[model samples]
Target: MTAMQRLAGFVLVLGFCIIFLFKDGRSQGNLLTGKTVYVWDFATRDGEVNSLTGNFTEEFEEALIQTQQCIVIERRKHQRLFEQRQNEKGIMSLDEISNAEKESLKSLHTNIVVFGDIYDDTEAGQLRIGISVQSFEGEILTKTSVLMPRGKKLDAESRQMAMKELVQKLVSGKDPRPSSEPIVVEVENVRFELKSCKLSGGNLVCTVVITNQGEDRELHIYLPNTRIIDSDAEEYLVKAATIGASAGSAKLVSGVPVKAILTFGTVA
Candidate 1:
């Protein structure tokens, strides 16, 4: 069939797909992979930078490097340059910098900036530190935090655990979200409710619940016409089928529900 036909067709006699139903058209790569990150020294509740502030910046950057996903931009050199320019312009922070200054800083390989804030919860006897990840385009991607005893910074193991949580949050934020409502397709008086699509034993398996909405009928299904097309336009044809109600037969009774599994062995 033509590309146009495939573009509009996910209806297989027993074939359907999970195309872009769960995606938002963004790059589907792991969140931090190759992303340029710039982490700042955390500001304490007193509005001052202390040793704890420096440790937050260093440890967080180290954790990001260990993942080997993002490109951690060295802040020292770029920060010195930024300071020198800011001094000459009599400005202090990013908020005071002009649009021209932001544009000029594009030479630095950077995508997101991490700003951290630490609060001393004396009553709770805990130190709460949160980091906000913001795109250079001014979008807040995520806000994550960890709490430790009020004494000082996190212990080695605690630091690792906290960093892992931060990484998990970043990765999950970029993943495709499930539909808010059920996805249903109707064809020839039959309704197909797409339950889920998953991979098993190296094959793509799509689970569907099929129901006859009209009178009992002969549902002639040409297997070759059934396939799964992904958002990348890659196609996987139906290789095997297991229909729970009729033992793979196509006869359908009105209002009868049948659960079926369509396997696409062409998956790689």
Candidate 2:
């Protein structure tokens, strides 16, 4: 049976839930830039893997290797690592990544991640392929979408052309934080703006900005109750927190914004 077929059966046995591990990795045209990348199996909109998606993903990885720019992690060789995140869809936005899964990726020693989907194109004889590339720091560096001949499956030359554009983009493009979309929360005028959440020195550090709109009432930030929650519904209690020169229990004034760094212990 094909990899897709086996994965389909495996997914069915697990109630059809598809999960993945993602971390930082990267590009093309250079002789093995020593950057690590992982290409996931492409899937249909309904989350089913098919020959078209499978072939395209495999071909793209081969193309990337040919350019001698990246070390593509063969998924078959790391099946257990891919199985680490056991209850997530195979494809999702970068923001949905959880802390535990990020830790898994770190363990995998990856630097770049590539995933894509196949959609019906506007034209009659083509399929729309949308691919996204993300860095280890949870940033979506760039994305590309192209139409391929329907049922033809791209030949070696066409696949090379496709990966060449993406590799060039990665090589030339500076990784950007497309995933950091201003995660803001408010509770009775205490606006908390999460600037970024990332792994640093084996701990999860989340930088947040707190705005006190309490009209000059001393904004009380009770550090003992703060927690860093992940997309997986798992909560990591803040082991250390700080604001400016203060290490813990920092207060804010009305209309003044104070930056707080909340640190959590390693999820592993």
Candidate 3:
């Protein structure tokens, strides 16, 4: 065979190899990356009410306080309930909650809801979080959450950090007080394509087209970068994509298609 033919053959075989080996991994990672995470927010329904005096004797005041207490208590209960559900039934979203309870919870808060999931991965060595936020009217608010993972070998602190970040993202909006960071994930560009792929000399290259994607998560996209792809790409691929890094996640802003490039190749 001619050298040109050999080169072509080599290229084809190398391309196939790179794609074959990493294709599934890439697909899985991207699938997870492009996931329409149903960030399940704990439903909220209660008129905002605060009293420094703790004075409440009217029936309406009693009911309001009871309603607020129920909201907080229910959150605790949900912690256990959702934990159990996750163990036995898999991750639970607020949407999975019974309709009756949904209505009841809806009556508690007209402005906020909480929902999310924590994913553990040993390969990426980090925790992945996906959250869904919805309004009291049952409309999806935001289906984004930050990922937190144990950066190193399994240790108590790493595990604790993961859980802490997970919880922070899950319930960051609940607190009226300001937080160092917010919980929100925005996909600026979601692209998909199949093209020449190869792994040579320790470098892998696969060109990818940037698709229109991203959420205007103002302060919330600062959560640790989740391992969407285990490749030779820099972490900034995800971080630098944003205009600026804020300390927290963004609020749910919808109706806008995340700017995405329809196609692109992978290079490593």
Q: Whose lDDT is greatest here? A: 1
TM-score for all models, in order of appearance:
0.46, 0.49, 0.30
Off by over 4 Å in 2: 1-33, 83-89, 93-104, 122-124, 154-160, 177-194, 197-254, 258-268
Counting clashing residue pairs in each candidate, in order, gives 0, 7, 57
TM-score of 1: 0.46
Give the whole-model CA lDDT for all candidates, comma-separated.
0.60, 0.57, 0.31
RMSD for each model, in Å, please? 17.1, 15.7, 19.1
| lDDT tens digits by residue: candidate 1, 1-268 | 4544333333544333543343322435554667788775666645567666667667777777777777887766567545544223222124434565576457676787676667788899987767656566543344457777775454766655666666566655553433456667777677878776654443666678889898985553335677655443557777877667543446668999888877777333
lDDT value for candidate 3?
0.31
How far out, in Å, is residue 73 in model 2? 1.5
- Local accuracy of candidate 2 as per-residue lDDT tens digits, 1-268: 3555334322221120011011111222332268788886666655557766777777777767776767788777877766754444445333455676667677889887776777765469776666666567654445556666765555767655665665565554443342324445565566666666555443566676778777643333344444444323445566776776686544568888988776766431
lDDT of 2: 0.57
- True-vs-predicted CA distance for residue 92, candidate 3, Å: 4.9
Put the candidates in TM-score order, highest first.
2, 1, 3
Worst 10 residues of 3 by lDDT: 52-61
